[model samples]
Target: MAKVFIYPATSLILSDLVARFGHEPLGAALSIRERIQTPGLESPPLQITPEDPKKGLRYAAVEVPSGVRGRMAIYGPLLEQSEAAIIVTDAEMAFGCMGCARTNELILFSLRQRGIPLLELTYPKSEEEGVQFVKAIREFLAGLQEGGS
Candidate 1:
């Protein structure tokens, strides 16, 4: 299987998806604080970063660009290297985000325009619900694989 990029809004959701899918996540925890809190969110051994830009890709980060500076900082590198991206949002729009909705929409639009596959995930109402959602995603990916084969 090729590398699949999974981006979840929270560390918990990202961990659950990676564990269930049997693919070790890449940068599931983006920072020192996250790494300390969630030690299990490291990239799998299979992951390789190709300098050529074709064979390797990075996982998308959660930082949304709110203004000119932020936009310049975040999107260029992400949209350039990622062949596919997964975006997750808290079901209730937590994080007390001020300008996130618009920013996310624009990012999604840009990603789509580049023909990159983007999966948008929403948090489930309960833990069980989250599991079910992950299962559904797994099944969906399975179907795509089978069809592609």
Candidate 2:
């Protein structure tokens, strides 16, 4: 079973990738509850403190620093012991939502430097678009599996 860190992206592409391909995908604090139902590792999801003061204390969206670190900490060892990593991101837009962009960049950079095969994808615009995205992702995975590394 290949391990894929979907990273935090718009929509639910990450989870979709995991569900469709049967790949192990790490989830953030918010997603942890949902992901627990899936048959996989029981590691805790990442949780980051929010940088926005407007959000007040105890404010942590899914894509905060803690979430990123949580994901990295939990998945880092798994990735180190595994064969590859797959990260999904919005190719069209630059991340600018507080610390989310930074976290994403770090995750992307780490995965790239680790020499894991990286596959970047743009966010889907519509239902049909989502189908296409999933198809493309699945095809990529199939190619990798068939090539036998």
Candidate 3:
């Protein structure tokens, strides 16, 4: 199964859909879960370690805001592990909001640079659109299963 990165990594809908389609979903939920569950974590709610910023340096410049660096530390590794990705734009905050526009841009740029299989879709505004959106995602994921680009 392909490892599919869902944009707005916090979207449970996307994460569930990806998993339903038989691919591993790489997103913030799983990452944060790992952090919170780590044996020696001092702050489960914070879900961050002192060295996270240093790890983030691999993805962002040292001069960038530390917030961006910290976020990248979590997302960068997911991007590296992704074999495919599904990105939904113009999504509502409830759908998933990364909470940082700069980090979002960096993540998108990095994904594009990777040249992996990517399916970019617009957030559905109506029931019809929602159906089409899910259909597209399913088709894209099925294509991945078939080893087609």
> Local distance difference test, per candidate?
0.44, 0.50, 0.83
lDDT of 2 by residue, 23-131 (tens): 6554342332333353422333333343432232132245555645544444455445444555555533321111345445655676677766567766677889889
- Candidate 3's C-alpha runs over 4 A off are 30-46, 146-149
Ranking by lDDT: 3, 2, 1
Q: Lowest lDDT 10-mer window, candidate 3? A: 35-44
lDDT of 2 at 105: 68
RMSD vs true structure, all candidates = 8.9, 9.6, 5.2
- The sequence of per-residue lDDT tens digits that candidate 1 reaches over residues 1-149 is 32334443235455455446644333223321322233232222233333322321222234432242243234445555545555555644231121344544655565667665456767678889878867766764443331122
lDDT of 2 at 104: 57
Structural similarity to truth (TM-score) of each candidate: 0.47, 0.54, 0.86
Q: Please say which candidate is ahead in TM-score: 1 or 2.
A: 2
Which ranges of candidate 2 are over 4 A from the true structure?
9-13, 32-75, 78-82, 91-99, 146-148
